[model samples]
Target: MEERTDMPSDPTAVDPYGCGCTECLTGEYIPLERATEVHIADMLAGRLRNHTGTTFHLTADYTIEPNTTLPELTPERLTITCPDHELTWTLATPRHRPLEDHHRAGPSLEYSDGSARVVPRHRLPS
Candidate 1:
């Protein structure tokens, strides 16, 4: 992927139509676990953009997991998936006000045919 000089250095600076971010312009994939709630919130708020130059809205759902904290505390899970694309991510976070979720995004890096190559989202055929 070719790096674009006009891309936004900060993710927040990019619009919902994710054309100006390094991920969108350069097809750089970041681990979902490294993503924060702010990133998910941005997606929910039509602030997070995808490589397609469009806003991707993420849906939040509650799930049950092993409670490692207090007995009264429960772990919450947030799953984000793109309906029109092969994109899915999950964030395991605490059920508190200041929620910090773990998530991973971007296309698959594993591609085997005869050579080693990573096919970016934009490079995929429609």
Candidate 2:
């Protein structure tokens, strides 16, 4: 069965982005940078755990420096725990581009099928 709630008079009021509608008194929106970070981290960790459980850690280091980048498709400092080693990996400044962009560029990680997978350096073409 499907249930439906009446649409609010000011639809933006219920929107998390809070488009300045009259009823949007305190709606909050997730900045692009933060959203990108969370999405990447969650998807990456899940895929690592599934494919490389021996090396992936659920509590591995994951952080986003809000002060370093604007909420756009720009590079931001990112550090992620390696899946097959005892060391951490640093993207230095991972751009907030779509997962496809990163995958195509052949970074240390790739995102696809709603998950992020690791791509080894050796896999890259000369």
Candidate 3:
């Protein structure tokens, strides 16, 4: 008699790119560059709201100074942790073109902390 072992057979489980996982559930196309922008915007907004008691509206064209150091996006989702606030945010790239880009470009987001992420536009939900 031969002993048999059970193995997981999900494609997402075996995916090398880290797509098809729960972390990447959105299945959106977000490039690395774009995702970072979102994260920075969110962090700045939170800080302003918390410390100054004022709400700041974020625009896509917001500029991130070249001196700022942020995390790089991976094939899987990006997680950013803010040391000051101890907040963690998971960013998913937009699958479609950003509304401001005439629906032809992907968008990215950044969370609190110094982490940033981007997903390509084509990966977004149709």
Question: Once superposed on the true structure, which residue ranges of model 1 sit more than 4 Å away at CA?
Answer: 1-7, 12-38, 45-75, 96-126
Question: For all candidates, what are the clash counts?
Answer: 4, 0, 28
What is the lDDT for 69 in model 3? Answer: 29
Question: What is candidate 2's local distance difference test score?
Answer: 0.37
**Which tens-of-lDDT digit does each residue in 37-116 have in candidate 2?**
33344345442222222343333123456664322233344555545444343433334443344445544555456444
C-alpha lDDT of all candidate models, in order:
0.40, 0.37, 0.35
lDDT of 3 by residue, 1-126 (tens): 864344322111111122344423432222222223353444443321122122333223222346532222123444444443334445543333333443355443434354454533344676
TM-score per model over all chains: 0.33, 0.21, 0.22
lDDT of 1 by residue, 47-114 (tens): 55432443345444544457533333323545665445445555444344222212112322222332
- The weakest ten consecutive residues by lDDT in model 1 span 97-106
TM-score of 2: 0.21
